[model samples]
Target chain A: MNNIILKVENISKQYRLGLVGTGTISHDLNRWWHRVRGKEDPFLKVGAVNDRSAATKENYVWALRDINFEVQQGEVLGIIGKNGAGKSTLLKILSKVTSPTTGEIKTKGRIASLLEVGTGFHPELTGKENIYLNGAILGMTKAEIKQKEQEIVEFSGCQMYIDTPVKRYSSGMRVRLAFAVAAFLEPDILVVDEVLAVGDAEFQKKAIGKMKDISRGDGRTVLFVSHDMGAIQSLCDRLIVLKNGYVDFSGDIPGGINHYLKISELGSSMNYANVATDFGIEKVTFLDKDRQEVNSVMVGQKLVIRVDYKNFDKRNLSLSIGFLDNFSNFKFACRSDVLDVTYKDNIGVAYMTIDKWPLSEGSYHYNLAVHESSVMLQNIKEAGSFRVEKGDFYGTGKLPGKRGSFYIEYQWE
Target chain B: MNTKHKDEWLYTISSKRKLIDFNFKEIWRYKDLLFLFVKRDIVTVYKQTVLGPLWYLIQPLFTSVIFTLVFNNLGNIGTGGVPPFLFNLAGITAWNYFKECLTKTSSTFTTNKGIFGKVYFPRVVMPLSITISNLLKFGIQLGIFLGFYCFYFFQGTEANMNQHMLLFPVYVLMMALLGLGLGMIISALTTKYRDLSILVGFAVQLLMYLSAVPYPISEAREKFPSKVALIVEYNPLTQITEGFRYMFLDTGTFTWFGFFYTLIISIALFLIGLVIFNRTEKSFIDTV
Candidate 1:
């Protein structure tokens, strides 16, 4: 018997670039005329690549371009990509929420998706009633939900309010209860699309832990899509990296993450607004102690950086700066939201300052991104690189004990 | 596993689907869901309202009263010796069933877009649930209708229940299927051309007047313009309403020709609706 539980072959989805309206009727009639005569769709032959940043000349764009992959039984596959890189489109097609414009998908057994939690839950219904309703919507039999209702309640920790209408429950409680019902589904193949992005950190951890158990212990095939690289690294056995509607990398998890990280390297050029959608960081400059632009800074001095950004919407953006090592490992990120940094104008400058930078002599690169509500609008890896030259420590003009990325000053007790 | 089941795939999803891709087996497997959706509809519809389930009876009662005032009293329309209240109630009862089923099932794609976009199930289940759920409402209204039926009977009226009343369930089934069939076609079309949604609202309202809901077909044929009367004569709803009134009140036109004509038309429309709905179900989410 074959172990492959799901097989996708040459799947692609094309979407009209603008509003779908009376204008499409003509094109639909044309397509129908061709189809009636046993000919291919006339419009399918021409479409632009899926790139939100670039301006499109054609009205049709392929959301997922000729996607093909397979999942083996019990293997957790991670799909990581930027917002419009066809991650959600591919998941939608796989779950049959929408069909591909071309090609097909072959599956071995039952496939269910947690595209959004509490999908069919009626807010007027009690929590207990919702369990049955949501469970049935997810393709679970009544007897199956009945058999595991107790465990689901216990897991959600909402047993006290199980009989209350969901309208009275908090949003967090709704998510917990909804996920509890879905967790007990135990389908042969589960396609999850970042549904864990909800709730607090603790519940997310518990949910991820439960998913790992489902795949590892029960041997179920899972296709997980998320932007949280930490969760992907911990939960997925294999990974697929999508870039602009194409499979950029598909293999071992570590290699795929590295490739994904390197995809945004060297975005240092000036003025991206012409091509970028919504918003993009136009320029990044590193300033020295004297407020002079420089490529390198001395260790033990302040790390001063200035980021120039532009937006079409003029909405306040949450800027993030992350430091990565040469091996593409993310060390730390400084988020503007953490420090109450915000800019409301369409074009504004953002400054990130780290007083008394503690580091040894080495080269390091930082990534820049503009975010709104955790959804990244623009992301640039290796936005700029800087070198740290040694500076006098303790006024002794002498080096620390050993040279490393981080330098620590200590005295023996 | 048997050798026959060795290479079997549970399902295959693609663009190349047959014209009538009805998944009877999938709908069967999700039978529990169908009933649960129906329960949700019945239970939640009256939640948080003051009148609650009473609203169902109030609507038909008020509509029949207005019909009595406007069409019966004002228009001087005769009911073939049957009381005007009973005459209009019978037509309204049957019309409401078809109207509710058609309107509810017609918006299946738009109303359930949130759930449909996130999950996969037999798309037919949602509309089928509407047809079934509306039956419960119809049943409750029938209680009120039966109350009126007994009130008029004991008080002595020309109308009397006969053997044709035995086909009551059959009539109800035909109306439900006809509404669902026509609604599914409108629903599938509305997924892309949303303007049809606006059109469907007034079309249904206009259709009620065109049918024999507020008046009898024999009277309309006698008084109405030839073209208008001809349209009313061929309408499937006119036949169903007329047959229902004939069965209960012992009035209106009823013939084997009209009965089979409606039966065949309803079944044909329903099968055609299923084909178009199946094709739209696959990709409606994109346009919707």
Candidate 2:
């Protein structure tokens, strides 16, 4: 018997951005006519991988372009991509929620998708009734559902309100019930998309555990998408990175995570106009000890984030430096110059330092700003962003001893 | 033993067909879901209404009474010897079923888009389930007609009802096919235009009058000789409804040619509707 359960070839999905009606009708009609005639859709011929970062003239752009991959039975594949990278579009095509503008997806057995928590849940129906309804919608038969019904209820921990309408349940309870039904579906292929992000911490751990059990114990193929790098790294045996609707990288999880982090940090085009107005920060510059502009710096090396500006109108200004990780979750923030610094004249330069930059060996972003006495300065939000290079924060190729953005070295007796 | 069986099962599952194209066996396996939807529609529709299921019977019965008065008594339309009440009731009942099926099926995508967008069931199942549940409602109304007929028969007041009434199932099926076909075409189109949805309610009413639900074709034939009556006679729904009266009431006409003509037309239209509907379901979400 063949072990390959799913084959996705050159699959791409394209979506028109504005009001769906009237605007795209002619384009849709032409596309449909071409499809019926068995010709390559004309729209796919335009656009390149580099076209993603900059907006282009073509009305139609591929959301997922020429994506070719296959998943054998029992493979747990993780998909990670920043916003607008077409990760959700890829899952939507594979799960058959929507058809691709071009390319083909071939899969054996039923495919169940948990695209969003409580996606098919009817608020008016009881939890139990919704289970049956949603289970059926996911392509499970009544007998198959009955066999796993008890296990689902127990797993969700919503047995007390199983007969209660889902509308009355709390948000956490709703996601639990939804996840329970989705994960227990036992389809030949399961496609999950950021569904666990809504639940509580305890439920999230349990959900990941159940996903592992599904892939390992049942030998079902799984495709998962999430922004949580740690979860993706732990759960997926293999990973696929989507950057602007194209498969940028597809391989082992560690390498995919590294590539994803780098792209996110480098992708944004910094705006200088918005940066100068905030935090008494008239100007922000990256410099070495020699006060020269430096484009790149090694990890753990002496670095400076210089904010030069005015103490206008005799107000107290506090300068703060914060570090953010690839997922945009803040790793650490600290404020210096807490004491009242009064300057009758308008200009001065304030420097902040990271002696050891304990950040894990990955690209990190630092935001430098001055708050008006504790409140962040105006325009500070727009003006601050700088990259930190990989240092020997945890030795070479080793995970930060702790599962967090940066390792904070502390002493014990 | 468990390991061996599990291994075999896993192998078989992976080896199953990919790119499933509307398998009937898979649909049959999800029969419970179909029943639940059928039950949900039946129960929820009348949940807060005062008259409840009585609305079903009262609607056609009252409409039939109105027709009998305006078309038969006032306008002097003939019933071919059957009482005007029974004559109008038969046509109105059958026509109502077809119209309801068409209306419900046409609005299938718009009404269930919320549900369909969230889940993956055979898209056809929803419209098919709606057609069947409506047939159940039709069955109840048909029962009311039978009661009226038995009352008139035992009382010896009504004229002869034709024995061809035994061919009732054929007419019922024809009505279903016509409704499904027309409904599917409208449903597929509505996903794109949506203007059709707003006009459908009134259109069904206007179509009722056009189908000769209130007056018999025999009477129309006497008044307007060849051309006008010929058009009404050939109306696909005309043959089915008039065929019902022809079978049960022993009245004006029953032509094998008319029945065959309608059966052929309805079947062809239904096949076309299915093809268009199948293609539309694939990409309707993008537009909708």
Candidate 3:
């Protein structure tokens, strides 16, 4: 039997930019007129969901556009996107918090959404009372709430303060209680929207583990949204990459991650040249093995970054490059400041290059700093990044973790 | 995994209406939430008030005092031989229930929009819970009204508080239905313009004046023998308020014509309110 629980087809949600109310009265009237005439909503037809950053003639933009997907019973679908990529809007539609402007969605079973923790918690109510209140809000019966009350309290670890009002409880305590109620209630369709962003690292880890147990152990469909790619890769069986409100990629987890990383890297480079204006440097390039400018270079190749500076004062000029790992950790820094070189020539021009990048098969960023060894002049943190594509030169080597910044070949015989 | 079992489950409850309309069964299953909502409203309403629950009685007591002073002393408003305090107290008790229910029910959507947006239950359960919770306040006020009734009766005062007072509960029920109906309509409307919200206070005040709260229907009836008295008596709340005064004080006249008129209007408004409220709950988040 086909166990399709949710089927969404060409779902699109259009939102007028800016204030939602009286500010859009005239536009609303025009929309009403177009609606009455049985024409396409004039605003929706011309606006593209993917053109959020691009200048448009109309003020309306589709927060979500042409989204299509189906979730089978007991499938955990991860939604990953950058800020303002319409992940929340899509989840809101799926959870029925809002409706789609166009297209239809057919869903089975009741949906329970933890759009935000403590969503319905009355601050004046006691912790125990709020658990029952929140449970009821999540559609649990009184008997069900009573039975789970102890478990919920135990999970929240706020048993001593059970009688205290939630307003007095700390934010972490509030989140724990809220998440406890939502998780314990066990709705058939659970829609979690970046709720893991709350609490300390330990609590986030526990919450993620709890979510994994909920999806894996229970036969409930889950839609998890987060900007944390590691969490998405770990918990989601399938991933959907949203770019400007449209599904840029949707498939198995690894492929989706690859596409998402590529899109994000391209986005960083699109504004790369604009970012180099502060420095008196005219050009910055990522050079590969054969001395060619490329964004992605093969692993274990001669990765050289050439920078051209404008001043002839080598005494006052210094160039530095920093290597950032895949998770955006700064692995190490190489600087010309360490070298005792001075440029006191008549012509004000100099070039410096790094040989043999020594990084593995993953993404790395290099930043350039041009100034006196003692006085800092210009520092571009994220100057540029290039992907180290998998290569056969070192054969297929395993990294320390399941996936990390780079794959370093170690001779451990 | 079994196709036969899947088909059987599908065929058993495949009616289109069951899918389109809200499943009241699911709401009934969530009766705990309904009870919690009611409990929250009741417990939190008088949390920080000076007298807490005693504030419920202060309204009718104060209103009774003012009525006894102004109407009996200054305006010479007759109470048909009933003590002005008892007459006014009974009217105020019944009027308080109507007014509270109307105000509470109407603000259900606006007041609870935060909760409503987060969760899904029978949205009707919210207004229903408000209508139920406001009863606690009304119940306390009614007890105070009854205390005065008993005191005056024992004092050999001719307030006429007797066996016919059993019908008081019926009057209370009608007032509740009337308030719920009107409140639901306004609650649904407030989600859009919010203009109705500001007017609700004035509307409640005006409704109190139109109802025979400080004055007995009998005196109004005697003054305007023909048309105006007929119209005043025909007012649904007026009849219900006057019915309470008639049952206890025996001052106002009661008729099946006026009672049935109120009964029909109350039920009609309630049903209309329910239909509109249900529709509004589904999409009010958009406007709200």
Candidate 4:
């Protein structure tokens, strides 16, 4: 077994809710006085847990609380959570960009975090100069950057404009250059926070390939935080799921991913409100052909989406529904005009059914929109979501698992 | 993968804020970052400007002429027999270094919020770079002052260059330390109380008058009341500037007691600044 490279014990961060200047001084003084008298901080006990959904009377909230974990050398750990889950806070603390409010982290080697790409790049500086500056900011020595300078430029594919100022480069080129500098950083422990969310599809593939090489070839530990479940499932050896500033799950990749998906389904299901009160969508729900409200369906089962609307006005209104993969990439879309459906009712439900769904096993979200002859009335992205389980589609007792987003009919010669 | 061998260092970060945890070795290890930051500050400042580094010479030159017009011609402030232009240039050159360092470093957290929010480095590297970069500007301004000094000296004016001039480096170091110290203190405090940032510019300008930059302390002592004279005399920067004039131009009140007092005060302020800066750097990102 590889040795444990990092240990985080009971790390918690408490932040004041509002303007900290006026009230903070008194708290600072009170804490100082109590420390002088050898007493525990009286305010430390008064903070509420970081539950963004709930209203609280206390002025202080813990963004992270009692977070404990350990990482073995060469292990890729994925942290997954919904928004306000404190994942970024934990990464910030681990990166030493900010200190924890309580608890300790023990580490053995250097940690380089790409909390953001192009973090310290100056727009006026040339790409070459920014490579050096950003590399140094990411904890690479000057000599080391010089050694990798050629490789970084080549990898970024911006060698033609290495001496040109970054401000002159396209946004895609900038992200590529920034990612190249960070990818060359050879720290023992690497912490990446959604850096792969940048660049085009080709560059993202290249970036993920590079990360995999870094983790596998050098036997370095990697802490990756991303909302892209497909990438997380493929890249991580283990996972930690955070919810409301607490560790909701920590185990193997599938277990943690399952827990996270379950929580997300629960969270998103509640958001099925009438988002736009004026000529708006009232609710969206997912069900099976049996008309039962199903949280998920087998890949080949009949999947139905029911979108309820209000204030329709019966004015030649058309509705469109789109299916998106976990990364929010649209897989397919269907419009009511194509189906030759017209709604005359002011408030009613429109159901879009897909017989023998062609999607592979993964989580997907539905986006709904209503338009009156092209003038958009209501558009709700990610109105509801459902999971697709593995099922045989080709009448062979086999299914495509984590291969791609969909299934296509084929004939074997 | 040797289980029997333990790592050389174990870093533990807790909520407990230590009073003084300045890691000099870590700063040393990141010295390359410090150098690059200094280079960035110097190179980027004059990139698109027409006059470029020439602005360095122009700033002190114009300020000296203005001082000659207002402080010398109008206010009748004596320069102790040294030409008013030369005297004003000398004081401005020295004060400019300290002022630049103080104001730039004072906004470290606010100005570098983008960088500090993303990555981890020795936070002191930023202020250290400002001090170094400002020192370069100070050097250029000093060179101009020397050019003017040579013209006055060749004209056979009563310009005195004494053996004490060898202590110029010491004076520069003292000014840098004092500026860095005060800058760090203000920067740390300004992270939470943003109003202090607004006060820094005005306060530094007022401090310049108090430090006798445009007027010598001896003249201020003769002109002002006794209480005001005592305040000007006790100002640490006043002694530093006065000693600088005594060394370079060889005419000003140069007392061993004043030198020692300024030395003690600058060192004390530096230590206090370090303590507070160290404490603030850990979590200032949250507030800033």
Candidate 5:
């Protein structure tokens, strides 16, 4: 069994919402007074859990609440969450860039966090100089950096401009150099937060490959935070999902991903209050052939996507609907003009039905657009979402399990 | 939290605060980073400027000229028997180094917030690097002053060169510590209050006059009333400038007791500043 190298016990971070200067002094005094009397901090009990969607009169909010986990040596741990879910706050605490309002962390060996690329790179410094500066900031010694200088430059692919100032490099070239320098950091544990989101696709692929080498080949612990579910699923052995500053789920990749998808789908129900626009989609719903609202349908079920819009202009409008997989990749699309369907009413309902839907067992999103010829009047991305469950399309007792996104009929001799 | 396996663990982070928890060993381990930061400060300042390093020479030279005219010619302040140009040059040379270190280090939190927010290392490394980089500039400016001192010496003018000159390094170290200590305190405070950021420049400017940079301490004692002269004599910088001129120019007073007094003060201030700095560094990112 692998050794547990990092342990986080009930870490929590609270932040005041307003100007910190004048407001913090009183809190500091309160803390000091409490310490003098040998009592617990008075303000720690007052803050509410972090939820950006809700309104509150309190000034304090908990950015992270009781986050606890352990990472074994050579284990790759992935953290996933929606925006404002306290993912960055947790990483910052583990990195020691900021202190938690409460709790402790115990780790074996050094931990290097690549929260952002080009963190300390000076624009006026040459590429060679920035490599040294950024490497040192990441906890590499001068001798260590000198030993790996050639490898870093070669990996960055900026060998020709090694002596040129970083200000002269393009944004892509800078990110490439930054990632290369960070990739060479040989720590016992590496904490990375969305730094792989920069650079071109090729460089991102190379960076992900390097991270794999860092954990598997070098046998080091890695804590990674990213919203790219595909990357997380492929890279992480275990996953942690955060919601409203709390750990929603922590387990295997597939289970955690499914739980996150279900939660987000439940949160984004067809509420017209959030989809108010001048001439756009007022609400979107997924229904079966019987016109009953549904969120999960069988693979061969007749799925109907209904879009209600208030078309302020009474002109004939064409509606285009697209189906996308869980990764937001377009799987298929249908346009009203292709089927000779038009809407002439000021307030209209457009529905597209796919008889015997061919999608496999997975979650998906649908996009809606209302247009007149080439001019787009309204467009809503990922307007509605649904899940396709396992079902037999061939009338046999067989159903597709963990296969690809869609299915097709075939006959073999 | 158990100490039984504490030896096995390599790193531990907690909410425990200590008053004088200065990690000297950790700082020694990161000496390479300190040197790299010092190098960056020196190399990048004049990278694209046309004057390059000559700007270092021009600033003090012009400031000394202005001091010579305004204080010597207009204000009738005497430089004992030494040439007024050399007197003002030496004062500006030593003062410039301290002022630069203080101003730069005082803004450490604000200027390096981006880097500090992203990574973790010894926060003290930033201010320590500023002191060292400014020390290099001080060395250059001291050479220029020596050049002028030699000319006046060879011309049979009263240029003091004595055995007291052996203590020059100690004097420079004291000045560096004083600047670094005050700068750290200001840097830590500004992360919360931010009013100190605006007051530091104006305060340093006013402090220069009280430090006897443009005139000798004796001149102020004789010209001003006793109560006013007592305030000038109390400033720690007065002893430094007076002792510095006493050694090189042989014109100002020098006392061993006063030198030790300033040394003790510098060390105390440095320790206190380090305590405050360590306390602030853990959470300054949030407030800043």
Candidate 6:
């Protein structure tokens, strides 16, 4: 009976879009009247899906619709999504911070939500006082907090400033103390919403260890939401991807992550006709050494790039391709002049070949340029991107974790 | 709807809830949170201030003095043949408590939208905590009133203290309930229509005049028209203020009918406020 600790049944939340003003009350009035008459809520028939980017003539959107899931005892489930994907909304509903518009969620035990660290923290309260207050806000009784006060203080490393008001603690120390209190919560189910995104790296490690302990050791269930793929890969046994407020994918960690990777990848081929110069690139295609087009390739594999151009004005211009990381920061560039290649013709093609692509396991975007004698002709940034999966870079099948966006070939004696 | 899992599940969260489910057990479970919130309010209010707790006494004292100067001396309003200063002091002391509970609790949702959005607890804990927290301030203000009460008693004036003083605690309870109840109603309404919150500050101030805080009910009856006098008589806060003046200075009218009428109304408003408050708390975060 206790095997399934939580069951979410057909949970959905409909939200009225735009400003909540006069029209909102009229809709509320209409819904109430319908409810009194034993009719379904008219707004429940909203057709628009929740897409924050688009404009809508309709007044309503379904933030979450018929979301169904269950958590077994001691299982860690990760909810991965982009911004406004209703991750926070689902967590809020599960923790009873808000109620779902339709259906229900049945849970067997206590649910503690860490939507944010230090909920109800008063800056004027001393660190020790805030610990008790924060713990109580998280549904802990006074006696329970008192018993764990010493351990919480030690974990926070804020023993010296226990009596000092939290207003004086540095932002980092405050997060430490808040997270420390959170770590001690003995709830049967914990709902975390990107709370691990804060705090230092070492503290985050400790917090993650504590979360693992809470779920694995104590047999409590956890529903975690985070954008960090590594944390999801390490902590969650199961994963669900939410896109536009719907469950787009759900499965084992690696499978869900791969599905997420594919969904998040952008176009691999792009045309440059509109941005063409006198001697400009017409198109760019990412390919393997076999000349087969691909959007993703293994690490340390040969990557061949083909650039088709139209040298209408017949200018002596050299082609260039620059690889950029996620932030659009240039890591390295490939210039045609490296091989003393320059072109001045009616139309032509260019290529950049790397025997071993050195970028680490991550998605990389690239830019294109055509220049003549230090005078830039056409520079198109963020032209296209491709993904690189992990591979056995060395002969040994061992790989160090991601330190940066590079894997250069080197040797030592 | 199924019977097998219904009883086994410890909690069920859904869109529809009982209209009058106060969930007192949940509030009781969060008693520690309630206590800490009360402590935080009381302690943080006076922090880094030079006067600190003295400001509690000074607030009513200064208000009483101002009322004495403006309403009694300048406007020539008599205080039942007793010293106008003490009479005004008594009314202001009780008025401050009611106003404090009302103004602070009326904005519970707006003031606490941050914590409420991020966490789940009985939302009533906030207003209940405010009501309890303001008690400490009211207690101190009562102490100051009593200090003056003894000073005048020894002076051997016509301010006769009576057995009506036995109802003092009852009067304090009614004030808190009325303030807290009205505040809950307004705050709940404000979660959707925020214009209601903007009206609370000035509304409470204007209400003090109608509640007979600066002057006694007897004066309002004698000076104003019968309809306006009826309005003052029917105001619930008028009963508590008159009860306090009667207890401390023996200078205001207090009838059993008016007293219980206000009491019944306070209890009714409180229950109604609780229902609205409970309904709003369940889903206010969406609108707020």
Top candidate, metric DockQ: 4
As a whole number from 0 to 100, the lDDT of residue A321 in candidate 4 is 82
B30-67 per-residue lDDT for model 6 (tens digits): 99999999999998998999989998888888888998
Question: What lDDT score is found at residue B203 in candidate 3?
Answer: 82
lDDT of 1 by residue, A106-211 (tens): 8887889988798788999999999999999999999999999999999998999999999999999999999899889978999898888888999999999999
Best by lDDT: 4
**In candidate 6, what are the lDDT values of residues A1-413, reduced to their tens digit?**
54788899999998878788958777878989999999988888875787877788888888998898888888999998878888989999998888999989988888998887876789999999999999999999999999999999999989999999999988889889998998899988899888877788998888889888988898888999998887887789899998888888888886687566556635343333344355478877777889997767678889888888885366667889888865457899998866688877677777778888888876667788888878778888877666778877775887778676678788889
Q: What is the lDDT of candidate 6?
A: 0.86
Candidate 5 residue-wise lDDT, B226-258, digit = tens: 987888887888888888888899988888888
Q: For residues A251-365, could you state the per-residue lDDT of candidate 3 as single tens digits?
A: 9987787677777844356113533453455566766656677767675556666665554444566667677754677888777768765444433444455444455566666
Candidate 6 docks with a DockQ of 0.51
Location of the lowest summed lDDT over 10 successive residues in candidate 2 chain A: A267-276
Docking class of 5: medium
C-alpha TM-score for every candidate: 0.82, 0.84, 0.88, 0.85, 0.89, 0.86
Candidate 1: RMSD to truth: 9.4
Better of 1 and 4 by TM-score: 4
Distance from true position, residue A66, model 1, in Å? Answer: 1.4
Better of 3 and 4 by lDDT: 4
lDDT of 1 by residue, B1-288 (tens): 112453577788787878767778889999999999999999999999999999999999999999999998999998988899988999999999999999999999999899899999999999999999999899988889889989988998778877888888888988998999999999999998888899988999999999889888988889999999999989999999999999999998788899889899999999889898988999899889
Interface RMSD of each: 1.8, 6.0, 5.1, 1.8, 3.1, 3.2
Per-candidate interface DockQ score: 0.50, 0.32, 0.39, 0.53, 0.50, 0.51
**Candidate number that wins on TM-score, 2 or 4:** 4
Question: Which regions of candidate 3 are displaced past 4 Å?
Answer: A16-61, A254-267, A270-280, A316-318, A336-362, A371-376, A395-405, A409-413, B1-20, B161-167, B224-230
Q: Which stretches of candidate 4 lie over 4 Å from their true place?
A: A265-413, B1-9
True contacts kept of each: 0.89, 0.30, 0.38, 0.79, 0.83, 0.82
Kindly list the per-residue Cα lDDT of model 4 for residues B1-288, writing each as its tens digit: 334555533577677776788889888888889888899999899998999999999888999999999999999999889999999999988999999989999999999999899899989999989999888899898898889999998999988889888778888888988999999999999998899999999999999999989989889889989998899999999998889888889878898899888888888988998889888989999999
Please list all clashing residue pairs in model 4, or write none if there are none: none
lDDT of 5 at A17: 78
User: How many steric clashes between backbone atoms does each model show?
Assistant: 0, 9, 1, 0, 0, 0
